[model samples]
Target: MNRDSIFISHATPQDNEFSIWLTSRLEMLGYKVWIDKEGLLGGERFWVTIQQAIQSSAKVLFVYSKNIVTNEGILKQGIENEIEYAKSIALQFHIQDYIIPLHIDDSPYNLAIGLPNINHIPFNNNWAEGLKILKKKLEKDSIPQIFDTSKSVMAEWYENEYISNCSIIPKTELFYTSWWSVSDLPKEFYMYQFSNEVQAKAIRNSNQTIPVSLMSNVLSTFDAKLSFVVNRDDENIELKPVHTYIYSLNDILYGFESDKFPQHRDVENHFKRLLYRVVSNFLIYKGLWRNEMSNKRLAYFLPKYEKIKKIDFTYPYSNRKKSKSILGKFESIGMWHYAVSIQPMLFPFVGFSLKSHILFTSDGFKIIDDDKKQHSYRRKKGKRFFNEEWRDLLLAFLQRLKDDNEEIKIKVSQEGLVMKMKEWPEMFWSEVGYNDPNSKMDLDKIEDYYEEITEESND
Candidate 1:
């Protein structure tokens, strides 16, 4: 019974997720948080324990939500009892601002019991923003923090109680990878020499249809007859092909044994860059819009054109199959487009992995340009997505790219040079089993409860 401890009062099951999240965050910041979860033993008196905890705690965090009130705006018996008891304790101890209300939903302040007069922290729209304000308030109150042992205690609790029991099982399971396996490529790599340094520099600086890695006075490409006209101001400049070389694709895919060219590591790096360019160009050719992220990485997104507005796919939900669109327009937040960033991998397997991203547009055409706003909106929109939802979204986007074919082919040049890859890489592993505590929980019930509460509050 530490006097500095913060006690959390929340409705069971309904507000469980938010309570756990808030508790974990406070504990990580070295604040001792007491939540009524796995605390009382069987047959123990719950109200008696709660009263004792409130008496000893410095502050009580009341998670004010619609769950704590009925349709008549009357407080539930259990929470009403707890809040009344906490108020009495505060008066007896002469504690100022003893109770802090964390408004996690759209519940009206006027309908809230023992919270109308008090300042409530907002978390309905943004949890992270609410956390920042809460932290400032906690600091102002000079809440005692046990910096040394708090982190270790939190880690121990997470391992022992947070995660469920698990055991390794001798069963095979198919693991889907983001990687797309490369199946075919051109055999020869050519080094094209230009007539002059200026022409070579112009070709290197300009965007080309074929994938290439450039050096001073030389350009390395897989296409033997790679030729492009560079437009500069009022002049059209064509780089002269003065020299050529025969380089093996196997040496690039598999490790090279020859010391005649650059270092194998350098060659591998250059080839990877070329492959990335190929993918980028191919996506652009397929009418996907590109946007650069805050970290300078380029991500390609499906545009809002009628041909590919929404990608439909089926996924496992509950114990049954469910169909949904991967990308579409929402009235609340405009259009959400499925985007992906790619990285070409050469070790263990020759493949390119696609990392998924979500991009937003106001009218389903022009993308929102502000990076900070984009990031915040993305976080808010994606927070409710389950693991299966994210996986299916990525899979659906990949299927859209593959169309009806088993492979996606990118033409490297007009000389019939093409790079072909499978839709997805095949992977398998021995599965480990775990008893998920939330496996039987009904998500639909939770959603319905939230919706009901919101409607009641609005009324």
Candidate 2:
């Protein structure tokens, strides 16, 4: 997009695969990204070409690698080139310091803390988010300036088909997904299509032209999402609907009580929807691991119910996976009303006696009991109460609800049970239908690709 080109300073032997992947993605995005693979190919003086590109470019991107710090290759390449270029250009041109370094979470760019003024984005969590960071960086008006000797670097780059301006950081393959925040997407509208990493880029760019395909033109199929949201104002995950669900907090914890008013606007029905959701989701996960059945393409699961709770305030980056099993159970019930557990542990509907007990549990939770009254449950023992008889359980619960309050209007929506993925990236990454031959990609299309994925083997 720019007149200037980017030089990718990277280690050769160690990061060969990553370098290849980064170049392809950048090219697809229509950016001129320079890497050693494209630039230092021929017998042309290696140092001369490197210095020329550094001189002309508006930007220099260091795909910082641990290997780069340790190994040395031709013409002081990798991190060294990136740093040298930054110093030379910044001092001469009045540039705003466009020398950028990207790194994984563990390694902060400064060789020493609080130094290097090195601005980098975290690539550990999500690939799409990381790409977002780099795109903004490249577009900034504050790019480092050009040097005099670098005057014709841009011209030389184009003449030799050299990449310029943008350089992809290493490790893009592991973390990126086609999914992104709703507001972050390029097109306001997109279609529904099932995709994996190899073809995810194709799905994203399919919307660029009008006559993409039948599926691309259909409409967005993102789902309601479940994530630990730091900012409540994120576009895909809005707070307004959450606020509505939060208002129903009282009924969810205790029990739906009927009143002269709206009775939580039908809390029990909502609860039933949530329960169906949970059961179906559990099945989906089990199914994924056991069979090659493909999950239906679905849109983001926007929180229809927002839950507000007293905060126990469990920050993430802590071990919370075990408890997620129980929390997932709640989500299945469709109780989207989310809450941060004020206590480290909470058992919903707790009962030592047979009267009442917590039915749902999740990871990262604490139980809060402000009221000291212990709930004791007692019922007529029916010799007829059989485990296999589901009707009995249904009748008993219905009778209990009826007795609790006649005003309580309970109507579970009759909508067919539709279960999308119950888990996040883990579930998405887990291979499903790979064993099934039908799940493979079209053979004709695979032949058309420059490099098809391992999906062909599965077919």
In order, the Cα lDDT scores of the candidates are 0.70, 0.34
**Per-residue lDDT of candidate 1, residues 1-459 (tens digit):** 458888898877677767767776677667788777653211333778788888878889999899888767788787888889989988987889999999988778976555899999988766666776787788788988764544555446555654534334456544566777778878776666677767776765664656676666667677776655788798887766676655676777667666764557656766777788787888888778888887788988877777444454443222544454656875466788778888888866777877888889887778888776687667656666655566677776665666465458888876768888666454545475333244222121233434443353356
Per-residue accuracy of model 2 over 86-184 as CA lDDT, tens digit each: 677767886664566655334445452222576666543433345557655765654432324333333354334422222233331222111211111
Candidate 2: stretches off by over 4 Å: 1-3, 38-45, 71-78, 112-115, 142-459
Tell me, by lDDT, which candidate is best: 1
Q: Scored by Cα lDDT, where does model 2 land?
A: 0.34
- Overall local distance difference test of candidate 1: 0.70
